[model samples]
Target: MSDTAAAEAPSPSVRSLLIMAVPAILVGVGSALVLWLLDLMSEGLQHILWTTLPQSFGATEATPWWIFTVLTVTGAAVGLVIWSVPGHAGPDSATTELVEAPLRPGVLPGLLLATVIGLAGGVSLGPENPIIAVNSALAVALLARFVKAIPLPLAMMLASSATIGALFGTPIAAALLFTGAVAAAKGGGALWDKLFLPVAAAGAGAVTMHLLGGKALSFQVTPIDQTDGWMLLWGLLVAAASALIGILLAWALPYVHRGFHALRNPLLISLAGGVVLGLLGMWGGPMTLFKGLDETTELLRHPGDYSAGQLALFAGVKVLALLVAAAAGFRGGRIFPAVFIGVALGVLAHVLFPGIPLSLAIACGCLGIVLAATRDGWIAIFLGAALVGDPVVLPMLCIIVLPVWLMVTKAPELVVHAQPESAAAKA
Candidate 1:
């Protein structure tokens, strides 16, 4: 390497890096605040819907009728908002990916409103997708107006990284997810150089979320102390089975979406979807109704309380609920509900075959299903390991994920591609 050649290379100087870091950190903090505010609003509304209102009606607890009513009405409310509100609650969630191009500022308010209602109403979806979209849109618009020095693409990256960090309670998830993406892109300088700003944003977002007392994604599970040949085999089987299940769900998504859209009226479709979800909820019970984070912890808290059949039912019902909610135009993400299904399936595996270690089963199940659903290996592996909070399960998950990845590599994704005319019609 000649001195002149090295000097001419595109290296980020400390001053430039520092200049970028300020905005990155600020974006991270802002992203976390947005997530926190949404969560707070949702929780408050949830209490009113499930507790105060129910109690006022002289229902000491959430009965089947109440569940049916709340979900059914929630569907109508969300539908009304989408139908009447400006921006129609942004793009159809079925058509968007976790990360995508920025949306117009006008679309965000309706999107956020729909998301809040879905979250509070016990819809079987997570805040990841809508929240990410909201944050990304806001960050891009704001940065473009105030900080023109940073490009739009980089702004999007910072917002996404920050949100992922806040959601998972760690910056590493964002880093791992972006590593492959950055590496694949045509760029100059070292890989770390490209990653520097995103990582800084993710770290700040993670720290801000922690400071805000966000709950951790991991749960307490029996740690895997050792590995054996049999465990590896069982891990492979569990992951493969879960992956197949996810693939099936992905294959069905578009058809289900079509069925819902056939109603040709957003309100009616949502209402019908809500009725179905209510039935599923009544059967699956409260644990299967909302995004699966807290429910996951509750399930793992006493795995012994459920038999294999019950575990299977939970997983099955939750899967149906997720499909219905997403297909019906309810606005939210699928990742959290998918995690619940995976956890339930994993626990079911253990209940049926006690020989396999619990941690491995859970990790592999989560890894497979998430991989199949998102088609993102990095996020899948991260969620799998994060769920178990066990490093020993990593090597096994790394190997198990390979075959599972192959299984879903060519599978249909859980998204819809509405025709241009149809999309405009909805708009």
Candidate 2:
């Protein structure tokens, strides 16, 4: 087409965008509701397991023995659900990403069951992966049934975006995450044109979650009001070290998974994993339990209460818990647990070196670990900034992420790829 003809061609109309927004908004709101419901259910179950039952036993709270028992039983229950329930809890979570093709509607119930059990049972995994899968499957089915105008891919994207927004309590996180994927797609529209619907969906989801009393992902930290050359150096060192730890965990994940799967029976593998996780929980205490959101807040609430050695121990135990939980076939996401690890490591850094600013250390530590774990620069940086709720750390994070990214760019990711059918069948 001639330049003049191309210039005169009409772009996607605002009316069309508005029309699509209706379903996008619905998807967003629905996604938030699903997440909220899951949280409610999980919290109730958690209270029962950790509080009611403990009180009934004449303890004010869970003892080490109690943590071990509950987690072990949780593992057995999840294993039974996966082994006997339909859809086997929707594929081994270690084999999936944050987003994928929609699962069959039949698979969602079992997946949700396993996820809730793990979440409430104090497994270290987060609700992101299973919740996203659940939302995507439902969204796709509903859209295909009632709104045929939207394509399956678009529906899936909308659902994933919405869930991510709800997960992080902000649409910006979703937009930052999807920008590269959308921009690289083989489409003909401007970038904003492509982003419009997903962003709309994300916005709706974020707003809905906020209205529903979902807490913000960010927390209070001593703000870094000033920056210096030493701060930059500290940020780089902390981030790089944190990234290395995350990368090391990723490297070990497959082997850990292989060892667990060697048990062949899902029940045995999960049961064994639960035993290990329970032991680790005993060591890490309740601070290292759950998905780490509320725990992270608690950790930051009184950093002075923990010695440097205690911080180190918490970070170490949490890492082990995350590894065991993911490898043992528990259904959940790794990001939130990873964030907790990063925060702990950052706190350790501050404790060890009082000269380093706490907020900067925490931000850099989170940035490096998240970048290594997710292999997504935007998300890594976003979480780092969000954790501190400060913009002053952004420029530092952007710079520090470069070297950490290079360190982890060629490392194995914290996911298990599916084996070939022949190998799988033999195994």
Candidate 3:
């Protein structure tokens, strides 16, 4: 055996690692497929749903009261399942856990069901990680049934790699996300993992999306470069606002996480939660109602067409939607929504402070949320600038991300909630 292989395999030898990696490859590919398919179905489902929402009865300026009722009822059905099911609902997930969870092949059904309920039932959650849970459960169940000899770690690694590749919308991002998550989990020998599997999976996912002609998460716009010297000040202002918003959002997470924990009647609890969110949705526009990443893309794509009321309405609504989504029984990602919120906030800044370039405001706004979500200045910088697609905004994204990141870190107590362990150990 080669010295490198001998030293680095998850197992004792290069041969064993190679043997294990085959299943990992299957996992990566399959996970990509499932992730895309589930999201496609869920998004379609959500679309059909919005049309049916009971807004016609009491047509008001924003979301009506019936929107709350429908949301509550939908949440109640989902809550019933969560209340009955064990090992699902209301906890940090596999990615967030930083570790591979205990493998129970039987758990896939519960996880997927809960996730469907989460997305379809009006919760503002993302599908990527939940798909990981469902996929992990499915893999475990299938392996135990058909391939009893497969090592647990191999199964999990494959599943995770696939999930990462497909969900992040790129293989590279998937590799980084999974690697970071694994490191946070503290799994030794995880560094030995190759990027090949995840990359292949990302290709598979992209292929699937293209095949379906599905609307992609990203809408890379033609960047507008009209940068001015005034952006330095603009970055600072956006950073400060982001910090304030971040701190408040962080402060609310515990209460939000805890509220779900304390509810007695799970269905009614979700209903009540739904009502609160419904009310909040009244403030944030319909774009803020769901996860809002796609809606944000739609908004940015046609920003010139929207009137001032339209933009202001979205700004207020997104903040409330995020709060409502978290407070209720819905599950999903936050950073993307936070980015949208940041952009809308930046849009608000554009309206208020006409001197700062709109592109700079957009950059600082989006990055500020990323900084809050990850507490990573570097990632924040890249994401913020990349999102706006404007070179002029790049400098400000870098400058402002640091201050916001620093502010997020300053209040360390709230940031570290319940850290889950790495999957490699358990797997």
lDDT of each: 0.89, 0.90, 0.60
Clashing pairs in 1: none
Clashes of 3: 12
For candidate 2, lDDT tens digit of each residue in 1-427?
A: 6656644556578899999999999999999999999999999999999999988887634489898999999999998888878777887888889998899999999999999999999999999999999999999999999999999989999999999999999999999999999877664557788789999999999999999999778887889877789899999999999999999999999999999989877788889999999999889889889999998887777878899989999899999999999999899999999999999999999999998999998998898889988999999999999998878898988888888899999999999997542233223
TM-score result, candidate 2: 0.96
Candidate rank order under lDDT: 2, 1, 3
Candidate 1: worst 10 consecutive residues by lDDT? Answer: 418-427
Residue 370 of model 3: what lDDT? Answer: 61
Residue-level lDDT for 67 in candidate 3: 55
Error of 2 at 281 (Å): 0.7
Higher-TM-score candidate of 1 and 3:
1
Q: Write the per-residue lDDT of candidate 3 for residues 132-214, one digit (tens) a residue.
A: 66677666667667767675665565566566555545555555555554454433354535444445555555454455454
| Winning candidate number (lDDT) | 2
Off by over 4 Å in 3: 1-25, 52-63, 86-103, 139-158, 178-193, 221-230, 305-313, 377-379, 391-396, 412-427
Instruction: Tell me which of candidates 1 and 2 scores higher on lDDT.
Output: 2
- Tell me the TM-score of each prediction against the true structure: 0.96, 0.96, 0.77
